[model samples]
Target: MLSIIVAVAENNVIGKDNGLIWKLPRDMKHFKETTTGHYIIMGRKTFESNGRPLPNRTNVIITRDKNYKAEGCVIVHSLEDAIKEAKNDSEAFIIGGGVIYDLSMPLVDRIYLTKIRHTFEGDTLFPELNMDNWNITEKRDFEPDEKNEYPFTILTLDKKK
Candidate 1:
């Protein structure tokens, strides 16, 4: 299964200055817990933002740069190629930087969205999802704590059959 995982603010903003705008530790934990041991397909910029390939999972970077090379990462020229690289996995995740999200939105079977209950100033935004095409299969709400900066909700949405 191909899944898109993201954290967006109330205003749909996901990042600014090529990095995440907020620090939500719980959300980070959730992302790690869910995506661990799976193939993580992401855009080149997203990989750069993260600085390196995450351990324990296969890292597939999608980039237009034919000569692009990231040690320990499988580099592909397109999102389709990235998907193809991760085809054997039971579940592969598309970890985005806006463009990759947009490209994979229609092709993914599921979405794991973290809805942060605050607005942010950002250049990158999550695409508006049409509720009609999805069904909420699971949801968990969390309140802000000393470790986490904002209140948020984690939702697992499956494409409608």
Candidate 2:
């Protein structure tokens, strides 16, 4: 199954200037815990933003240009190719910047969301999730930490069909 792991602010902001907005340590921990052993797919820009590959996971980056390549990352020209590569894995994670999330949402089976209670001014956002098509299977609220500017909630949703 395909899973999308994202941390979103109250207004749905996921990033700004190709970087993450919030520095929630717990949320970061959640991300690492959930995607550690999975195949993680992201856009070329997202890969660049990180400066390096995340450890303990297979990093696949999607780019339109066939010539583009990054060290230790599998580069593909389309989402179809990425999915094909991850087909044998029990779960493949769509970890992203805006464009990748928008493109991969429809093909995913579940989502792990960290929803911050504060809105941030940002240039990028998480894709709009269709509530009707997803069922919230788990939810847990977390108190604001020194690193996080406001309260947040962790939610896990599975596709209805």
Most lDDT-accurate candidate: 1
Give the least accurate 10-residue stretch of model 2, judged by summed lDDT.
143-152
lDDT of 2 by residue, 1-161 (tens): 99899999888998898888778888888999999988999998999899899999999999999789788888999999999999999999999979989988988899998889889999998878879999999999999767766789999999997
* Per-residue lDDT over 1-161 for candidate 1, one digit per residue giving the tens place of the 0 to 100 score: 99999999999999998898999888989999999999999989899999999999999999888999999999999988889989899999999989999999999999999999999999999999999999999999999888997999999999998
After superposition, the stretches of candidate 2 with alpha carbons farther than 4 Å from their true spots are none
Q: Model 1: how far is 115 from its true place, Å?
A: 0.1
* Candidate 1 worst ten-residue window by lDDT: 143-152
Q: Each model's TM-score, in the order given? A: 0.99, 0.96
> What shift in Å separates residue 119 of candidate 2 from its native position after superposition?
0.3
CA RMSD, predictions in order? 0.5, 1.0
Q: Report the error of model 1 at residue 141, Å.
A: 0.4
